[model samples]
Target: MLPAHRLPHLLSQAVDLQVSRCPYHFEPHPPSFSSQIRYSLLTDHLCPRSEFPSETVHILTAHSDEVWFLVFSHDGSRLASGAKDGEIILWDMKGESPKVQHKMRGQTDGIAHLAWSPDDSLLLSCGREDCPGAIVFNTQSGEVKCRVQNSAEDSLTCGAWSPDGQHFYVGGTRGQFLECALDGSVSSSWEGIRVNALAAHSSPRSVYAADTHCRIRRYNFQDMSYDNLIEEDHSIMSFTVSRSGRNALLNVANQGVHVWDLNDRCLVRRCHGVTQGHYTIHSCYGGLNDSFIASGSEDGNVYVWRSGKEKPALVLRGHSRTVNCVAWNPVYPTTLASASDDGTVRVWGKEKAALRQRQLAAASEPTGITGNGDVSESTSERRGELGGGGVGGLATSASSLASEQLDESLSAASLAEVGSDWQLAVDSLTSSMDSSVGVQPLSLPSLSSRPLPPPSDQLPADEEDEDQVTGSISTEV
Candidate 1:
């Protein structure tokens, strides 16, 4: 549920008004439940604006080499970004200035992926190619806690924390997926298979992992047994689970992003125009209950889409090289972190362009759930529930702590001197936006996002032989 203080302002927006008036037309799911109503109320506010983020505020250089992955800690107190030069920089998110807490580098392999433990204490860094091992680091002291290496020749590609936070699951290309203890000891295994990505769920007690062979399987988490499959014959690069843990956003090789129904094992939606052909371009669920999806593209731009829309609603263009990944701050709804092959990590939030739009909005209309001071019947009921300290209030209390963290984080003032092109990008975006437009990269030569199709004689690889799969950045398909 939205905070009682935030509700009135959220409901007054143009997008919210339109969605609320004709619920069936705007959202895919019916607003049959109170939570759904709250979702619609907050959707447009926290998401990356169609106004786009080009120059409002962001870090110009957070790494010396190309960045591969970035993830915010659970409590949102810290941000860790891994680079292609085998460097991991941990940033302090508290206060106005984001300080670099640690510039960690021990292993030789370039960083491929990173995951934070449930409590924000331990961070797992998975390496690339030659030495595809996993390293666990103590977040507080910036010390190496443990290292997990593959027993065989396959690269250790992915790792994820269990819901309980006691253990983590690790897998890789042509390697057996294993469940390991905190000390990097394998306790259980799912042998003889290859997994490109993994997302563990607690409610359904299952693990949803990519098959890399145009399929994603829902495995029985307990026994590590295969259960169901989401079938779509497209090469999958990576994935991010939805906030509800009921769905998945998959980065398919040539066909953009696909939302898979975890429960039903089918394609729910296809978010198009993600230029992901030559690499493992990662995408993430961000912006208030995963209401928005942001993806890195080969064309050096970040494509952001509202969860309900199939096309990109906001295009973040700033990186000189290909954007590799994006991570939304968990505590602050509007803040976003993006990594790129330009050898930098860019942070985005409310700044000049965003503030200007807000200022105009404030002058134009008084946004409130109770328009003209007459609250809707449902909204009135919600207000009463908040007073009673019921579900709505409890949810508010949980988020209020997160809001407190937001009050402490770096402001948009933390920015490098932006060139005039930044303002032009923002001004052009603010004046107009066509959600139907395809992904367009700025200041870059046009290249086909499509990959060269596979050979006619080369048959599709089975699950075991997926390492032979073609068309990937550094063999990460």
Candidate 2:
């Protein structure tokens, strides 16, 4: 016994309330037939989807020898890689496919390390014994703009350009750390225990040098004095500071990588299982927002571990020999590059259609039919029916209709019209299921359409005795 005006308003309120509460209590009742169909469609839309795993997108293989060091310019447009064959290759990464833009030959022995100037106009390279101590070259022209020679017999281990790009810090195998100008003139020299690695920090205006004696010393350019930052049990071969400069990743020789909190001056995390037996392998931070750490393994694979996770997230197999270095493109977060003794740099990313196929495959596992025997078909046939565009087409049409209806005013008349159209659309969909015409079984796109290369082409597991030499410039006085 409701008033005419109150009845319509009350009915609308009841409908909205029921619609809002339906999703919470919409569990399928096996005891009912219509309920099962509703449940299947609802679950298909509501179920959480899994993400696709990243895969290799490209492989760069221009270096004949093992690639040792890789550094991307600040702008992330160019990547300079130094190989053991005394060659530095500049790759232009701005294109669809990474292309080798220039190749600069280093000394006969090889290029040990490479550092780009802050302005990306110059590149500093260190070489092995018998090669020049340090060379500052024009990045655009690959011309040796300046050369620093401490001694004819001295070998350079690591080098870093100052924040201002006016000076250079070059470490030698003979425990000699020399600060030189852009013109290769030595400004100052610090005689210390064998310096293995050097890193420059801009905020604090300091340079960090790791020595063979298991200690890291921070040298302040302001005071021109050095203070010990960290002292561990194992000899530190090389280290990379985090982008924030609040943490440092130290490569402890024979041991795994260790993360040190620069702010608190304490050990944060230890990423182990990266086999480091006879040589020094580099580690880098990558993944979304540098939340993961990637490193080379002596077992001929690339290992990636989340920041807090103890176990590695993925052990990528590609390198036939030791993976000497791993670099993530700064611009493209998904793109990763790994250098190996196999003389190749492989790029890893995700494929789109493969992702969709995986999603469809996972969705097909849950039985969409009810126990009422309305559909007596095998799972494969059911999958084919779904893939043939029945459910997808229905969903698309329903969504389009809903959107078109929603575009109009949400008055009572409009709502009634929309409800009528929706009921008719559902009825039409159900009727179409009785006939096979225009029904394409739901199936993934043919794998042959965009087939991936064979596994052998992606990750070569055969280990040939390639002359693998430690490109680390370690000179013992």
Give lDDT per model, in order.
0.62, 0.63
Instruction: Give the residue spans of candidate 2 off by over 4 A.
Output: 1-53, 129-132, 203-205, 353-440, 443-477
Quote model 2's TM-score: 0.65
In model 2, the clashing pairs are 173-475, 384-441, 384-442, 386-442, 387-441, 387-442, 387-443, 388-440, 388-441, 388-442
Clashing pairs in 1: 8-369
TM-score list, all predictions: 0.65, 0.65
Per-residue error at 98 for model 1, in Å? 1.7
In candidate 1 the C-alpha lDDT for residue 92 amounts to 83
Q: What lDDT is reached at residue 227 by model 2?
A: 82
Q: Which 10-residue window of candidate 1 scores lowest in summed lDDT?
A: 468-477
lDDT digits (tens) for residues 370-436 of candidate 1: 1122211121121232233444444443343333223222112211122324444333442332222
